[model samples]
Target: MYILLALISAIFAAIYFYYKQSFTYWQSRGVPHLTPSMPFGNLNKPWSIPLVDQVTKQYKIFKKRGERQAGFYLMTEPIYIPIDPEFVKNVMIKDFHHFTDRGLYVNDEAQPVIGNLFFSDGQKWKNLRQKLTPTFTSGKMKMMFNTMMNCTVPLQESIGQIADNNETFDAKDVMSKYTTDVIGSCAFGIECNSFKDPDSDFRKYGRLMFEENAIKAMKFLFSLSFGNLAKKIGLKNMEPEVAEFFTKVAVDTYNYRIKNNVKRNDFMQLLIDMMDKDNNGGQKSNFLTMNDFVAQVILFFVAGFDTSSVTLSFTLFTLASHQDIQGKLRQEIKNVLKKYNGEITYDALQEMKYMEQVINETMRLYPIAPVLGRVCTQNYTMPSTNLVIEKGTKVFIPNWGLQRDPDYFPDPDKFDPERFSDENKGSIDPGTYLPFGEGPRICIGLRFAMMQMKMCLAALLKDYEFRMNPKTIVPLQLGFGFVISVKGGIWLNVKRIS
Candidate 1:
């Protein structure tokens, strides 16, 4: 009886202390906020809520306080959100070294897949980034252009098949198959033919990585809000099978290429070249191990597959919603391709400025990762506010919310490529646009994703007109997973054009 009474007393004491600590966060600074609940701080019931919905809720709370920035807790861990773009830029770019890490690190000893480029930090990331930059250069991309286009032959034919069948098809699913083939061929140096085989290995694992499931959703939320705690609890951001299969594919491919004197123009060859160059472990060219080689290859496949798939889906979504814009875009494609004698070339893609604007706008609204995170390594003060943020704090750059904020973007939801036009693009602040993030750690695969997207769009627009099907879930809800993904899928119908 005394033991039970002691346990109840301990629980009450913990809750009371949590409330006191949470309330003191804003009160001590003379900032205003709603009273926070015990233990959970201001986020008492966020466990089951969708990420977008949670951000929207937090946004409303931040706006209500009328402060440029405010402190909140993700389960007693203090995190700061900068309501001003200037402050956000300061944290992300202007004074970046102090806040270089993304606040989320996985122990490679336990989880090798989690230790790849998107998650590694410090000198390891710097060295890896330097050694791999050449892989994405315009020269190297030129070498792989044919490999990328090789996937499009299947995509173009598949779209034609659907239009001929006269049945409405989900653009997301169709585009997923297309992108799966593109990444499979380019990254793995294998022909997946996702278009021909719906159960392609790449397609299967791609779905596993991003599908809305309880384990994945909870893992992501906890990882973002409470990194150490999540790690301690053994939460994972990816499926174990994904890592095993991709690693095996990369290792076997590299070994096969070495044994048979195989040479290809895709990303795998570049990995091989980088490994050969960086044997001595210099800062510019560090030692690349067998795992490092496979990690890069696997990361290339994992990162490229879903993001390109989603971007293609959003590209189709925006095009379908704006018929006039679609007509304008199609006309540009027709004119551009005609100049090339109906062959899509690297030179021609660069000339498609309107298509660039369209893609930029799609990324603007439906960024692949709607949220970004940074961890505080040391105490840093905000230049504008002089508010000292202590070490061990987490920060969230709400790319999803900030992009949609009307204060910065008028009629923010409208799909207007002209907003990114040369005339007006220079006028808007650069950091305000962070679809690919900013400063040192922005996405390394941006160039590849853009090339793949542009080629797919060009091939389709040159051939068909797409419209939204009633079957598509409108105002697309995000899939409940680590990456910013849409739920219920994006469906559309295509009309063949002469």
Candidate 2:
């Protein structure tokens, strides 16, 4: 018993000493840092709050300390958060080569889902990004516009039913179903019919993909704290079930498309064509395997659907909350549609300048990705500072904190779309307003996502008026998850225009 106790004591002592050394990393380097708690590092409880909120809180703390750059430990790992816009510009653009990889938890061999463009790093990400960039261009989007518009037919009809019943519904769920159907048709070349059948597998699996239960949440936190160790133990970035479901769906879809000799002007077709070329030994500038194809499709479906749905839902919620703004936006949509003969087209969608401003403002208040992360690819010295960020150091750009800063955006809490008006937009700083991020590694699907949101908003606003539902919690409390989602959903009541 004494021998066992001694061994246990030695193990604990080693761990404690190691953590002490690790926690002193930023301090030794002459960097301001948040004082870290033992075992959990800077976080008192690793899972105490939602990840988004935690990062935002840290951003506020570091900003209030009057520091341009500060460091904090997630467990033993040091993460650098840059508060200055100049520093953000350097990291995102000028010195981007030194900060290429997102430093996300990705283990393709262990979890194929992480092989997607979002998580993959180094040359793989570059190649995949180059290959997929053209897939979302204006011409490509125009080709897929009809398919996306078709999905909105069901969206309008379903929302019309709710308006008829005079019942409040979860706008998030409703918007998600519309996006699910859009992604199903556009990304996978299949009909989801989610509006007609809410329990469709596409909707179920998509919801499950984003669902953050306790166990999965803990695992995600663990991975963030101990990435190398987590990867060693084969800890997946996605839930096992989510990874499995998406992988299967990707594979089945690919096989079906190839077997049927299917070709459609959508994301899935582009991926399939790439795979076909590789199989046929055609010109191989950037050949894609079946796995790569599936990964890109899944990335498009997951990232595009969730973020856009949340954006659309929040736009509606905010519009409902402020009836005057909603009226103004609805009027703009009405005027734009009249020019195109009551038809919502890509051209008409773009003409709703005020609606675009509303989305911009909505995103500023509740940016889909509250914090963006990058890992140092090589040792980088700040241009004007003595601080040297070591290779492998994780860097965070606090999207929420920066966008909500009163200095950049006066009266930040107020939902004011004029802040994004053409006259006012030019006054905003270059790097201060990155709803879709900045630089080469910026979101490739920005055009597609904007197109999706515009069409849905235009269609909905043209026919129906919305107000906040009583079931919703006002002065909204955000969910503490990867994305900025409202807790208990953004409930809204709809009324059909006579």
Best by TM-score: 2
Error of 2 at 146 (Å): 0.1
**Each prediction's TM-score versus the true structure:** 0.94, 0.97
Specify the highest-lDDT model's number: 2
Worst 10 residues of 1 by lDDT: 279-288
Per residue, candidate 2 scores C-alpha lDDT tens digits across 1-498 of 999999999999999999999988999988887788777787655555666666677878878888888887887889888888889999998899999999877778876656877888899889878777878889999999999999989898899999998888999999999999898899988898987798987787888888876677678768777878998998766667766777788788778877887778788888777776767887675545666776788888888889999999999999999999999999999888889999999899878899889999999998888888898999999988999999999998888889999989999999999998989999988567778988888989998999999999998988999999888998898875657778777889999996
Q: Which whole-number lDDT from 0 to 100 does residue 284 have in model 2?
A: 73
How many times do residue backbones clash in model 2? 2
- Residue-by-residue lDDT tens digits, candidate 1, 1-498: 999999999999987876676667766765444566655666645656766555556765686565677666665566677767887898889888878888675767666656677778777787778777888898888899999999899888888988999878877788888888888888889999998899977788878766776655556656766667777877665678887878888888989998999999999988887776666453445435787787778788878887888788889999999999999999998899989999999988888999999999988888777767887777888886757877777777767777887777789998889988999889667656888889888888888888999999999998899999888778887663555665667778889998
Q: What is the C-alpha lDDT of each candidate?
A: 0.79, 0.85
